[model samples]
Target: MELAIVGLGRMGGNMVKRLLRDGHRVVAYNRSPEPVREAEAAGAIGAYSLEEVVERLSSPRVVWLMVPAGEPTEQMVERFAALLGSGDILIDGGNSYWKDSVRRAEWLRERGIQFL
Candidate 1:
């Protein structure tokens, strides 16, 4: 499957590497350019921002967030919600409370975006 992974910290970067190793197409992005470049060297398509990430994917894009929880995750969700159309998927791999996750899931679901 093709997907974009935002936030190329330790977990996120490893995820991209593993996915690439498994023959999955991965688009990787980070706040800093270094990790994105590193992931690109590892066979990921490096994207610097959410806009670029969205542009690189085909329809029904899937974006995974491996950043820290709270504001960063929330901001990413909101940004993607604004830019993505129906049928896109967002996977949150951060440490978040169940209640917040539930709230976010419903909010995205209402907009026809799947949350995981």
Candidate 2:
């Protein structure tokens, strides 16, 4: 499977490594360049921005976001909404409140994107 992961923090970074170990193609991104470089060293394709991450994926792009809940996640979702097209998938693997996740799911669905 091919996917893009945004945020290279502890859990996210490990997930990237595990996915690569399992033979998945991973496009990894981080706000700071260090973690992205680290993920690159670990055999994942490093992307500098969310747009570049999207560009690296095929149709129906799958994105796993591992940032913190509140504002950061929301902003990330917003950016995905702008860059991604219909049929794309956005997976929020963060600590977002259930209600917030629910709301985001509905919103993305209305825009023709799948949110998990």
Best by TM-score: 2
What CA root-mean-square deviation does each model show from the true structure?
0.7, 0.6
Q: Give the alpha carbon lDDT tens digit for every residue of 1-116 in model 1.
A: 99999999889989999999999999999999999999999999989888999999998999999989999889999999998889999999999888999999999999999999
Kindly report which residue stretches of model 2 are placed more than 4 angstroms away from their true locations once superposed: none
For all predicted structures, in order, the TM-scores are 0.97, 0.98
3-100, model 2: which lDDT tens digit per residue? 99999999999999999999999999999999999999999999998889999999989999999989999999999999999999999999899999
| Candidate 1: Cα lDDT at 95 | 97
